[model samples]
Target: MGRGQLLGREDGAAVFSSRTIAVAPGDDRVELGFRFSGTEVVVPDDARVVTNGAVVFGSVDCGAACAGTGTGPEITVDTSGAFGSVDVRTVTEAAADRADGDDD
Candidate 1:
């Protein structure tokens, strides 16, 4: 189909979302990218990854090192339903500069 249909968003320690995405019917892929770090990922329950290349997942981690596409697309998130992204970016404040460096 066209670009993935992004639906809803809910926020918490991690963000929750719903997106209606799909590859062409009969076709098994969509040109998409996924990257996460020190975080969690929640794929839609109804989604499928056809023709698994080097993709793997488990109860807690996305296996493989740190690449999305390798010789070819490593993983393809096939969907006609919703999925979620884990927003693990924490907000922090910059440290205040000491008066030592101030000319005033």
Candidate 2:
């Protein structure tokens, strides 16, 4: 299936306002795109990140405990009981690196 959208529900209803990034079938992985205010972020497969909301990348679930800045959109992924790596960067820095082909 293609990308799907999940909108937030109303009061006293099933509210699912959290955005998610998922990988499509036939591919080993997928990239999740997120836009908040004026910033855009990408959460890759097998990895996770936290922002102002919650994101479920795979078997892992991530989110914030309170409503605050830079702590909402959280992401989680199954590490398969192993330690993984996480790279955090500002939107501007991320974009600059992409433009310079200096992903390291």
Candidate 3:
């Protein structure tokens, strides 16, 4: 048996081990952005519960909302928290191209 090895001589018995990572303050940041059709939303604050580039919650926040650029629908969330999970879905090409690139 090695120093890092687990010894289990019984049935249906198991042992597990894990390592932890420590992050310093202002060391991590999260940016979430999305584009839709003809509108956009961009939040440049690097904090939790941020709105209009302002820090509504959490520390290490931004003073103002980031100015949005470019066309089309979009939403952006800039945060200083960890992103444990995310889910995304988009329309199919057939539905998106129904207007033949024409805006009326």
Candidate 4:
């Protein structure tokens, strides 16, 4: 969410505004969808994204192939147990994916 911006909680979900780093509690089976437009999202070394649903990617990480100022906005889905059953990580190319693109 934006700096100090409160998205306000409703039900059991917390929404975050774009353009800043934020962390919120997540369901065990969290669904992750990411679209940076012209920006990039980084997955920290310790981040674990898993699910029992459908997965199109074996794994993905924000490598040099993704360009950023290293301080862009981020949303961290952190949770476990019944609330952290499944997690989805979705990423659509703002630009085209390259066959030679370097990803970590």
Candidate 5:
């Protein structure tokens, strides 16, 4: 993937046999069924974690007290048939602007 992008299965599986992959933002919609991953996944730092389960954002060393239904832009981690925790993060203003293609 690109410098600031991450792509993989909901359960964090390799999409291709190659270690290098390239993807860009798109307007496409993807529909799936009971998604589950057996591994940890990485998502955009600014994306919010929306789920009824636990969420670890900002730091991996945090405890259960840090688990929360996150704020900001929504990134649904829970689906109709799946419910679990996710580790997320925050992004710097400059990085967020870059992700939005705002170089100024």
Candidate 6:
């Protein structure tokens, strides 16, 4: 979602991509589908992630939320010999925060 954009409560899930996926504060969920090689998924550390059929090399840094007990929303991923790894970390609420040094 764009900066200052707020999702309504009725809004559905967001689709994940290979690039940097920035999720807004009100985003409730995200769906990740990997059907090709070199696919990497990045999500916030606070998100609740559930993966199936995925072959990841590196460990997901889910932190205290790895057990699907985070206060944030859910993130589901399904891969079949396509995804390389998933890097989990805290993502800023807005993409512009990275450029304006607000994330620091």
Task: Say which prediction, candidate 3 or candidate 6, comes out ahead on TM-score.
Answer: 6
Q: Which ten residues in a row have the lowest lDDT in candidate 1?
A: 88-97
Compose the digit string of candidate 3's lDDT tens values, residues 17-65: 2111111233222233222111112121332222222222222222222
Which has the higher TM-score value, candidate number 1 or candidate number 4? 4
TM-score of each: 0.20, 0.25, 0.16, 0.21, 0.27, 0.40
Query: Per-residue lDDT for 1-74 in model 6, tens only?
Result: 31222222244222233334454555544444332223234456577766545444433333333477666667
Tell me model 5's lDDT, rounded to 2 decimals: 0.30
Q: What is the lDDT of residue 69 in candidate 3?
A: 33
Better of 1 and 3 by TM-score: 1
Off by over 4 Å in 5: 1-37, 52-72, 79-104
The whole-model lDDT of each prediction reads: 0.25, 0.31, 0.24, 0.28, 0.30, 0.43
Task: Assess candidate 1 and give its lDDT.
Answer: 0.25
Candidate 4: clashing pairs of residues: 27-83, 27-84, 28-83, 28-84, 28-85, 28-86, 29-85, 29-86, 30-86, 32-88
Weakest ten-residue segment in model 2 by summed lDDT: 77-86
Ranking by lDDT: 6, 2, 5, 4, 1, 3
- How high is the lDDT of residue 47 in model 1? 34
Candidate 6 error regions (>4 Å):
1-18, 24-40, 56-65, 92-104
The clash count for each model shown is 0, 7, 8, 10, 1, 0
Scored against the true structure, residue 97 in model 6 reaches a CA lDDT of 43
lDDT of 4 by residue, 50-92 (tens): 2222223222333431243234334333222121122222233
TM-score pick, better of 2 and 4:
2
The reply for model 3, stretches above 4 Å from the true place, is 1-65, 78-104
Lowest lDDT sum, 10 consecutive residues, model 5, at 57-66
